[model samples]
Each structure stands twice: as structure tokens, then as C-alpha cells.
Target: MTRAFLGLGSNLGDRMGYLKDAVAAMDDCVAVSGIYETDPVGGPDQGRYLNVVAELDTSRSARDLLELCQMLEAAAERVRDVRWGPRTLDVDVLWVDGETVDEPDLVVPHPRMFERAFVMVPLGELAPDLAEGWSDPANGDCRRLGDWDELVPPASEGIS
Candidate 1:
């Protein structure tokens, strides 16, 4: 199994709900960083985003992981109308250990992960070593909201 990281973000309706559902949908998801709320970085002006980095241990190939990302986004009903536009849920395959993939629609080690504070800040919480030696970009405000368990209650928590 390989250790992989995925970045998740939502800026539209039910942002936190979308995130919680995405996390639950991931296969072999081992750990998740604290959630962060950050201002929109690009595209037309939009609301802030709730972001988190999820860790997974899986035997799936990078392409499969990409497919899983797309599946999760679709489950959240994500719409791709504009580049870098606001989204209900965005799942990015940030990194996959000992693996590299370069294609027209996919790239491993996400081309711009290091350049965004929204990605690095939460990522650092999950994997500090990987996040080391990276300079965060001055895009906009990004702050930790809470940890996974703190922010997303257990599915059965409120049940009788």
C-alpha cells in the first residue's frame, strides 16, 4: 500500500457538509488534518472555503485515485463551470508516495500545492515532513477551524 494525500475544499452551499461527506466516502482514508477556512484565491470573487488534507493508505494506482477523486466530487454534485471557480467540493490528489503520473488531465505531486497556503497549512498538520522547506504563498487569509473529529461529529452521534 502507498501513502497518499488528498486536498479537499468547498466554497459553496453546505461547505462543511460536503467536506464531511467526502471524507466518509474516501476509501482507506487514514487521517485528516484540521479544517481550514480561507479566502478564495482566484477566478471570479467568491466566498471562503473549508479545506483539509486527507491521508490514505491504498494499493490503488494514481489514475484510480484520480477517478476516486472525481467520484467524490460528483457525489457532492460539483460543477466545473469556471477555472479556479467556487465549488461545492474539490478533491485533489496531492501526492502519492513512490509514484509519479503525468498526463493531460492529471499530474502527481499536484503542480501547485506548494504555492498555496490553503493547501500547505492543513497538509502540514497531517505530514509535517512533506510540508517542510516550503514557502507559503500570500494569497489570502487561511486559518485552522478545527480537527476532523471536532468539526465533523460521528455519523451515529445524534442517533438514539
Candidate 2:
């Protein structure tokens, strides 16, 4: 299985639940970073977001993974009416096995991930050394939360 990195975020209803649900639906969840609350990126003024970086083991192709992400978004009632709009869930295929995928719809290594604290902060949790080197714009105030399980309890906790 390929080790893939996914950036998960939610700014709408049941933010943490939506993220956990999306994580539950995936395969081989290796590690999930602590949560971080941050301001919106490119959308209209909206609520802060609960975000994390999820490292997973998957055999699916990059394109397939993109589809899976979209499916999760739809299930979360994501609306694309606005660019970078508030969402119930936002799952971006950040990086997959250090490979570069530049499809018409998806971009691996997430083109602008380095410019956003929301992605870098939690990413630092999973991989400190690398996340430390990553430089973001420092505009958004990303606050680290307490515990990963507490903020987003595992399904085994009966948090379905």
C-alpha cells in the first residue's frame, strides 16, 4: 500500500464529526495529527476551521483517491458554489508517496499547502522535521488543540 497524506478540514456543522467520519471511511489510517483551528483561506468570511493531517495507507491510484475525497465531501454536504468556500468537509489529496500528480482537477503536494498554516501546523505534528522546514504565509492564526482522540475521538470510542 502507498502511504498518502491527506489534509482534512471542516468549517461547518459537526466539524469534528465530519472529519472523523471521513477518516473512518478510509483505509489504513496510520496517524492523525492534533487539531488546529484556523481562519478561512480564500472564501467569504466564515467560521474558523478544525483541521488535521491524516496519514493513510492506500493502494488506490491518485485519481481514485481524488474521487474518494470528492465522495466524502459530497457525503458531508459540501457545496462548491464558492471558491474555497465554507465546507462541512474539505479533504485535499496533499501528497501521495512523494509523487507528483498534476491532473486537470487534482494536484498533489497541494499547490498552495505551504502558504497555509492550517496545513503546515498539524502536518508538523505527524512529521516534525519536515513540517518545521515548511514555510507558510503566517497570515492565518493556527491554534493547536489538546488531544487528537478527545477532539476527534476514534470510532472505537463509540463516536459513530
Candidate 3:
């Protein structure tokens, strides 16, 4: 199985709820980084985003992972009325071990992952080796909110 990283964010409504639901939907999820609240990078003006990077050990290809990301976003009722616009949930296939996919809809190792602090900070928390020597990006402010377990409500409690 290849070890992959998925970046997740939500800002429209119940940001944390959207994140928790996405993380819970991944059957191969192995680890999740601490949450980071960051200013939206681009797109019409929008609220801050709650973000995290999740690790998964899976046999799925990069294309498959991209599909999964889209599925999660759809489940959150994400609308695409505007480019980089406010989203209920945003999921990206950040990296996939030993794989490179350059497709119209997907790109492995996310072309902009390294340029965004929201992605780098939490990613550093889970895989420092890949994030070593990485510093904050100039795009926006990013601050750690807390660990995933502490910030997200338990499934048993339900999301409301």
C-alpha cells in the first residue's frame, strides 16, 4: 500500500463538522494532523478555514484518490459557482508515495502544497521528514487550533 496525504479544509458552515465527516469517511485513514485555522488564500472574500492533513495507507492510485476527494466535497454539498470560492469542504490529494499523476483534474504532490502554510503546518506535524526546513508561506496567517481528536466531536455525539 502506498502512503498518501490528503489536505482538507472547510469554511462555509460547520467547518469542523465537515472536516470530521471527511476524515471519518476514509476507511484507510491512518493519522490526522492537528487543526489549523487559516485565512482564505484567494477567491471572493470568505471566512477563515479550518484545515488538516490526513495520512492514509492505501492501494489506490492517484486518480482514485482524487476521485475520493471530489466525492467527499460533494458529500459536503460544495458548490462551484466561483473559482476558489468559499466551499463547505475542500479536499486535495496532496501526495501519494512513489506516484506522479499530472491530469487535468488532479495533480499529485499538489502543485501548491509547499506554497501554503495551511497545508504545510499540519503536514509537518504528521511527516516532518517531508516538511523539514519548511517555513511559513506568505499567502496568509495560519495558527494551530489543536489536535484532531481534541477539536472534532466524537461520531457518537453526532454532528449538528
Candidate 4:
């Protein structure tokens, strides 16, 4: 199985709820970083986002992972009305087994993972070795809210 790093964020209805649901829907979640709250970086003005990074051991391809991300986002009622617009959920396939991917619909190592504090901070928590030496883009302020277990509810308490 490939160890894929996924970046998750929510700013719309039940922000934490969306995140918890996404996690529970995953195949095998090995670890989850603490939650970080940050301001939106681009697109139209929007609410602050609750963000976290999850490491998954999965038997899925990059394309499959991308599809899963979209599925989870759709489950959260995500809309693409505007670029980087507000949404109930945002799931990004940051990296897959440290492999680089270049495709029309997806990009590995996330084209801008290093540029966003929201992604870097939580990611650093779960994989410090991977996060090292990367400069923060300073696009927006990112601060830790709490651990995933402490911030988000267990699946039993969330959606079925």
C-alpha cells in the first residue's frame, strides 16, 4: 500500500463535521495531525478554515485518490462556484508515497503545498522529515487549534 498524504480543509457549514466524516470514510488512516485554523488565502472573501493533514496507507492509485477526494468533497456538498471559493470541504492529494505526478487533472506534491501555511503546519506535525527545509509561503496566518482527536469527534459520534 502507498502512504499518501492528504490535505483537508473546511470553512462552510459544520467545518469540523466535514473533516471527521472525510477521515472516517478513508480506507486506512494511519495518522492525523492536529487541527489548524487559518484565513483564506485567495479567491473571494470567505470564512476561516479548519485544516488538518492525514496520512493514509492505501491500495489506491493517484487517480483513484483524486476521485476519493472529490467524492468526499461532494459528500460535504462542496461547490465550485468560484476559484478557491468557500466550501463545505476541500480535500487535496498532497503526495502519494513521495512519488511525483504530473497530470492534467492532478499534480503530486501539490503544486503549491509549500506556499500555504495551512498545509505546511499540520503536515509538518505528522511528517516532520517531509516538512523540513520548506519555507512557509506566508499567504495567511496559521495557528494550531488542537489535536485531531481532541478537536474532531470520533466517527461513532459523527455521521454513520
- In order, candidate lDDTs are 0.91, 0.84, 0.92, 0.89
lDDT winner, 1 or 4: 1
- TM-score top scorer: 1
lDDT of 1 by residue, 5-101 (tens): 9999999999999999999988699999998999888799899999999999999888999999999999998999999999999999999999888
The residue pairs that clash in candidate 3, if any, are none
Across 4-99, the per-residue lDDT of candidate 4 in tens digits comes to 899999999999889999998996889999999999988998899999999999998888899999999989989899998999999999988757
Candidate 1 at 110: error in angstroms?
0.1
Give the Å shift of residue 5 in candidate 1. 0.2
Candidate RMSDs in order: 1.0, 2.1, 2.0, 2.2
lDDT of 2 by residue, 22-99 (tens): 988887678898888888877688999999988888887778888889999999989888898888999998878857
What are the TM-scores, per candidate, against the unseen true structure?
Answer: 0.97, 0.90, 0.94, 0.93
What is the overall TM-score of model 4 with all chains considered together? Answer: 0.93
lDDT of the structure predicted as candidate 4: 0.89
Candidate that beats the other on TM-score, 1 or 4, i.e. the better one? 1
Q: How would the candidate models be sorted by lDDT, starting from the highest?
A: 3, 1, 4, 2
lDDT of 3 by residue, 86-128 (tens): 9999999999999998878888879999999999989988899
In terms of lDDT, the poorest run of 10 residues in model 1 is: 134-143
